[model samples]
Target: MTPRLALADMAATVSSEDLSNLQLLLKAPSKDAVRDVCLQSHRAPSRRLAEATAATLGVPVSQAAELVRSLHVLSHHVLFYNLSSPEQILALFPESFHSSLKNLITKILLENSPTWRTEAVSDQISLPQLKDLDWRVDMVTGSDSVSRMSVPTCLVQLQMEDPCPTAGGESVSTVTVELSRESLDTILDGLGRIRDQLSVVAGK
Candidate 1:
């Protein structure tokens, strides 16, 4: 049978027993390492194998999807977050790719934050603003091709207190910054240029 057909059949016939087998296969080591066992069983397509394997292991598809996406986010963090220079980060992609990359990063950051659900306080902060200044990213990866390419997004919230006094004589203020990949790049670039210019002046 064709690999795709074989995969379809495996998906259709998946059972507790199949799941058990897959679990055992996964236990051996990494997902790639278990490929031989999966291939020998029926030579299913990788996508089919992932679904079937996930089913067997009792992992819900949604949870599996999230896990897969997380890995992508992690990759971006590793690749760009620690760069020693703005030029270095910019060099990773062509100028044309920058806009899309920034957009993706922004969307990922926004999607991950729980504050997105909160109503904006006009005089205080909006969801995007909160996201801007304080958020954390988490990543996950899985065995499927889709999961490999998927970006899992989530946010860690930061707490801020208002120091301005309100009518009740209590401090009242809110702040947030919704950060996207593009916004982050813009912010970074501004800071870098300022530093560089400062250095040039100081040397004169």
Candidate 2:
């Protein structure tokens, strides 16, 4: 419950009004109903769901909607911190919360924790993976005057797999870099040093 944990910090974000609504929403007779609203909030808000929840809690629809939003954000915070235990989840509540209110919050988080965790993991942005590397050497033979100037250049292309690419769209992207001989040699030297370091590590 220390401020070091983000859940504790997020717990401080709840206003007194929202906290009151949350307490009422959790104290509803049917725990399943409360859990359903919390889970739906994770996806998207629905007016029908809010209205129904409002009726169940005998509060205004606005209050019910706000409760759902608070629960949604709270659940996300819980997932972010990967807090699994009821005690850890309960840390989001004020110390003044009675045992029943604390128990309800813990129950809601524990019941939906697995699904929330799975969604969180799946929502992570994947880093692009290197798929292929291509290089070509070209000789630049002259400029406008044709003074017999010759310079070698290397073109390198890096192809990477696009993680979480759009549906039915290209999943690969290429980056090209042109390097003069001097720059190319510097790159080769760096690569050589990396290879040597890797060899040393492998030997060890």
**Candidate 2 lDDT, tens digit per residue, 6-102?**
3333333445555566776655778777667777776666888779778878889988888877776677667666678987877767777666766
Candidate 2 structure, TM-score to reference: 0.68
Report the Cα lDDT for residue 178, model 1. 46
Model 1 C-alpha RMSD vs. true structure (Å) is: 26.3
Q: Candidate 1: what lDDT?
A: 0.39
Flag regions of model 1 displaced more than 4 Å: 1-134, 138-163, 169-176, 197-204
Candidate maximizing lDDT: 2
Candidate 2 lDDT score relative to the true structure: 0.74
lDDT of 1 by residue, 65-95 (tens): 3323332333223222333334443343334
TM-score of each: 0.21, 0.68
Tell me, by TM-score, which candidate is best. 2
